[model samples]
Target: MARLAMAMQQEKKHQHVEAPDGGWGWVVVVSLFISSALVFGLLRSLGVFFVEFVRYFGESAQAVSWITSIGVAVQQLLSPLGTAACSAYGSRRVVMIGGFLSALGFILASQATTLTHLYLTMGLISGSGWALVFTPTIASVMQYFNKRRSLAMGLGFTGVGLSSFAFSPLFQFLVQLYGWRGALLILGGLSLNIIVSGALIRPLGPTKVIERTKAKSLSDKYRSFFSHTCEYFELSLLLHRGFLTYSLAVTFINAGYFIPYVHLVAHSRLVGFNEFQAAFVISSTGVTDIVGRVVSGWASDLRHMRSLHLLTIWSALVGLFLLLLPLCSTQGNYVGLQLVSMAYGFCAGALTPLVFSVVPEIVGKERMVGALGLLQLIESFGGLLGAPLSGWLRDLSGSYILSFVVAGGFLIMGSIIITTLPHFCSCTNPPPLSPKDTKNEFTEEERLKQVLSLDSTENIHNTDRIPETLLSQNHITLEEIPLSAKRTDDDADC
Candidate 1:
């Protein structure tokens, strides 16, 4: 069992799929860009439909809010399943199926007659598709880059900002031309493009062989499947202290992170801004969001500081801006609100890529897919409650002021939590892997060659004089060698 474990670890250590840092990675980045836009970019713009749903269905704000909240929550909660599927099937097939599901949801949603229908179609179905599309795409991008990972993530996610800028007004225009139902049909068509993007995702690592056996009982097959899933999903990561703390911090951030995207338009209208003006506010923020992502990505790649430091600063600023957003409505000051919203947009965008980028640093790239999936799954609680909580506050108080304040508080709490991460105060980059960490880095073939060369040497009499470093490199302790393999002086004389 120990040998088997060591062999598996050695395979991971020696044959790591080296990040190209560029090359076909650039293509993966492009696919990430497209999928991100269709998924989150479209999601961010869905606020344009918030008022329409409220008025059309005559539902309370809190009730209508559940539509988006359910979708967000469902997408996040199912993320682990998506990553698991990516691990079993290739990412390409899983993502393509997800794309189809996403489009099917929208197309089916067009004929909905009730909010429940919307919840089932848009919230459940499309959200499931999003679950499959996001984690794998992000994981693929991470695998294809090393030093420039932050920048690649930033560039890929720029699609969200750009589409947010474009999709808001475009959605409004579509809603104006065709009722909400007709607009959904068009959106469904747009979602089909996610299928094409899925096709562009090339696997970064060699495919693992699917274990198989002769006929077995049904229970045996089920047990085997569960065992395979547990190994592939890296379920033990749940016990990792650093990962848990990081996930907790991110969950708090998630609680506040999406409040604006879901409510900013409604808040604008409440402050006496017209629909176009409200839409423009979100669109303008999207523009700054793009700038922030690019700038943050470029600066992170410069290696002047830790990505955690940048994330901490941006998270704090994002909370600060969220707090200030409510103040902009004191006298219905559109300009002030818009400017504050843009600032919030920039901070939000800057921190997003860092959120994913820092995971590799925290857990190492080998566990990225599982880490991302688990992170999303844990944070889904925040996403599940955030918007609806904000909406309930709005309903209770008849204003969004308290809601924004509470949202900001969640972000601030997240920022404080981030300060406790291991090595946050370090002044220098982390040291390279120690010998203990790299015990399996040497290849089996190299160890065999070294053994043969040592045996061929005429002057060497025994393994006692073998270099400790060489033994350590080969992950073999002196005590583990058999007595029969070690030559005795008496035997040598004979």
Candidate 2:
């Protein structure tokens, strides 16, 4: 395993191409944009329908909440499988199938009258579709860009915010006008955009080249497949020092990340704000999220510091703001929340790209698809449990204060873990070169010239050109070469 990793690293060092930004790449970006917007936007807007679903079904808040939560959990947990399918069959196929599933799920959901049906159609099918769509999209993006990868990924993920902003109100309007069934049907129809977007994404690189290099013989292919499968299940990442640290830190960070977003509206109401004011706080957070993503992308590219370090610092600051959140329960508190929200949004925006970026650096580009899949699979557990756990704390304590405090504590722990990463301080240093003695050795031409001189048993000395201090210090003797041999020596030097 170590040998394979080393070989993969060496291959990556020499083989990477600086990504081209225009043409088909732009087409893929546009496709990804539409796809991301549709998938994430639809997911985010579930809260809009949450209350209606609860009242209509006569279910408890926790029961109806499972509809969206289960869907999200399914999407996240299935990421590795979806990614593997993409690797085996092709991203194009996976995405197309995913789109179909998403549309079908939503349509099936429209006919549902019971929780079981909703779970099958919305939670299982739609969630699986999301897993298929999201995993492949990220893998494809990595294949497309190198230098501009973070920026591109940031831009692409902004589709989530775009969709949330545009669709939330539209979905609300649809629910008001056409009942939940009609609204779901409309959403199902709109979900076809995934299929169209999937169609737009042709395979990005030399698929033949990848296949040829990775699997030469049938036996080799079988072995490779088995090995990959094993790696996936074992999560070799747990053994990697940097990856383990990052994973643990991120788990803690994520444990707190969603709390503010989840409770922003309720928190606003608690402070005596009207519904419109509460709604505006959510809207403002989304708007700021857009701005934050863009700015963070630019900063990540332009700044000299390591992106992970920047992300860690920002995350810590965001956590600190969360710690201060409980103190603001008045009108002054609402204003404070908005400021913190914007700051947190900006930091969180930057943190997303950084989160995925480190995987490629830690593992190699070759293994990136698998690594990212596994990473998300693990982190999804954090996402799945974070908010509800916070809510549980709220239930236990009769206040959101302790929950926020716990969230802050987790974020701080995450920051500390991130600070311990080896690469955090090594970004300024170039990679260590091999043939260690080469650091102080003469040039190849000079070495060759010296070796050539040994054949004639003559030392070619140019005391005039050589530094006098070095010759004196070494107390070396110089021998003169014949004029005929000097020309030969010059030719050899050339």
Candidate 3:
């Protein structure tokens, strides 16, 4: 008990303090809104360049698919590094550097003479920027709000929809006015605004700067370095059941999540829609997507249902719509395609905020950054394979029907996996603070009892009761025990 309390006191010195839940958080949200517009919003709109890339490069769809896939892969695969950077330097510095890298990648890609050049410049370089930008920005937002977290996330992500609504057609126009190369150059210029967004992130709590201390030996120095790295990245989360299950479920969801963004425009053209018509289809969905995000955020904050429940419902709807996309195309119904795409857009947008909001539920707010880093690291595989597989299916079948079907399958599988989350089957949404407070109390009591039991073999299984005499002898009090014991039995005592 004394050790736990001592550890808790030491932890407070370096903790990533929770957000005040308001005030400058709104400014951070505005920053998030802009960052989302640049990152994901631009990503989804890049599909406007897909067919152009195929025609210009004369590469197979599968080969061309590697462009976006590699970018998404690198972004996710390197997220742990980004989080570590944020822990060492503040998120502001790391994100600004990311913005510069992102713009540089786009500018360099403007000069690409071959597909491999695109892969290196756009895929790796631009992806590295995204890796730096994404996890830190989301973690910043989570640090800012609590009860209103869903709404805050929803409002922030609406930038994706807002940008998509404008960017799809705007990108197509840029392509026509100047070639794809020129268009990419202009994108590089626009991405510089992300640096401004990064500038706006005033970290809500303690500055994340780590204090350096001299070590007695080289081995001690290495051990201290490893310890700091583990602490900053929360490597312990790897052993957490709830976090692991959530990561796996999100991985499957991610496998299907981006198919529409990457392929929908191309599929529209394949179904005989003209260029503007196809662009409009994406733009229209973007409008609905905005509505969905705002509504989802508002609804989630109502606290009438668990965020996990809302996420499952949204995931299922998104999968159902993905399945419908192919059906509408097979029937040669452009109107049906547009409507189904809009429906898919709404459900997908609605789920975005919930995706981040649910993290605090799985892991407490203090661990949000590391948990997000690990989650992105694990889910990167899905992001890596999703689009390329869809493109490959398109090449083999000469249509996108099977691609949509397979993507939907992945989403449905994700929905099923999420049902395995702890407390997912519970009927009522427990008041947030009550359960946490009660659980903390229960855990410390039980842990102290176990220690007492361990001290005396006669009381081995008598964990339900703590002898008062032993407590007096040990100079322990229940109130003095640290609530850090509020972790699952599967967790390490530390």
Candidate 4:
């Protein structure tokens, strides 16, 4: 009791409450928003320049696409490595360095005269930079909040939507005015915003102490590295119930998520809409995505909702929207497009943070960084495969009807898989018990009585019936003790 009291005192003395808002935390959010805008938001607009790049390079669409695809692939593949670096060093330095590299990659790509040069500069280097910037930004935010985490994440992710709205027109204007080379140069300069943002992400409160405590001996570090690396490369997620369900669900949902973005403009043209109308359809998604992210986060916090349930419900709605999209092919169908865009955007936006939030829930915060990295790697494969497959299906058939149908089918399947999660219905509830039914079967009071009984019979301590005042003074609760003197053992027998 004395030792426990001492420990509690020490913890209280060392612990600090981070400013729930304002201070360095807000600075980190701003920095992350900028970085996110550069990476994810910029990536969202890549299709805007895809055709131009294909023509300029005199390459097939498939070949030119490899540039963007490889960049995405590298970003996804190196996510765990980036997470490991953040865990070892700090988020601030990692993000700063990543920003520099990313900007440098774009600048170099602007000078590239060959496809190979573009691949090396834009794909590999820029991709790595993005991975570094993104992973740490997420980690830094997670470190800042516990109760308001979902809201914080929502605000941070809103950058993507905001950036899409701002950057798409900007990029198109720049490409038209200055050509691809000059546009790359301008965008490269813009990437420096990431560095400035990264610099602002200082550690908050006791997070520094926690990071220091995580440092291990050399051999222990090596063992930990090997274990994590194995986990990263392994397909063992298929064997883990929670991971399997998450991965499969996400795969299905993502198949639908990107297809709309990829084909929206083309579909608009097909339906006899002007280029601006098509762009408007894509941009509308961003507006709704921003709204969805913020609203969903706030709602999740208020409702104390499980992330999976929210994800499943939203994804199911998105599936329904996709099914309805192809039905409206006329000028009147623009309303349908708007509705589908908003619904899809809402579902995808909400699902992003909710998915990451669940990582900490499943494996605990200690392993969360690693888990997120692995999950990104898997999901990236889905992103890479889904869009092109949809495009190919469109080409093989005369229309996008079958393509969208397949995409909607995948979304529904994903939603169903997500709904099957054990804790989807009850975020606060413990998992189901096994045949023994002993792990989580007892009430707190019952457990306390059992402990008190055990202690009384063994006479483990010199003191008996320690008063509530003593327990309170020592920061111990009555629940910690089991009394043996109780007549009925029914509570303890389980």
Root-mean-square deviation (CA) per prediction:
10.5, 13.9, 7.3, 9.9
Candidate 1 minimal-lDDT segment of 10 residues: 485-494
Candidate 2: residue 125 Cα off by (Å):
1.8
Native-structure RMSD, model 4: 9.9
Question: Where is model 3 more than 4 Å wrong at Cα?
Answer: 1-18, 211-223, 428-494
Taking all chains together, each candidate's TM-score versus the true structure is 0.84, 0.76, 0.85, 0.76
Q: Candidate 4: where are CA atoms >4 Å away?
A: 1-23, 58-60, 112-119, 205-240, 398-401, 427-494
Residue lDDT tens for model 2, 186-215: 998998888888787766443323533652
lDDT of 4 at 1: 43
**Candidate 2: worst 10 consecutive residues by lDDT?**
485-494
| Residue pairs clashing, model 1 | none
Give per-residue CA lDDT, model 4, range 1-494, as digits (tens).
45433433443343333435445666777777888889988877766666567678886544555566667667777877777676556688888889988899889988988788888988899999998899778878776766777788888889988887777677767888998888888888999889898888876433322422432221122223333333333222233467767876786776567667666566666677765676777688888888888887887777566766776787887787778787765555788777777777777677777767666665444345566777777777766666666666766775667677777888899889877765676757355233243222223223443433422232224233232111211222234443211111010000
| Backbone steric clashes in candidate 3, count | 0
Per-residue lDDT over 406-481 for candidate 1, one digit per residue giving the tens place of the 0 to 100 score? 9999999999998898877895555644445434332332344343343334221233333222221223433554
TM-score of 4: 0.76
lDDT of 3: 0.80
Error of 4 at 245 (Å): 2.4
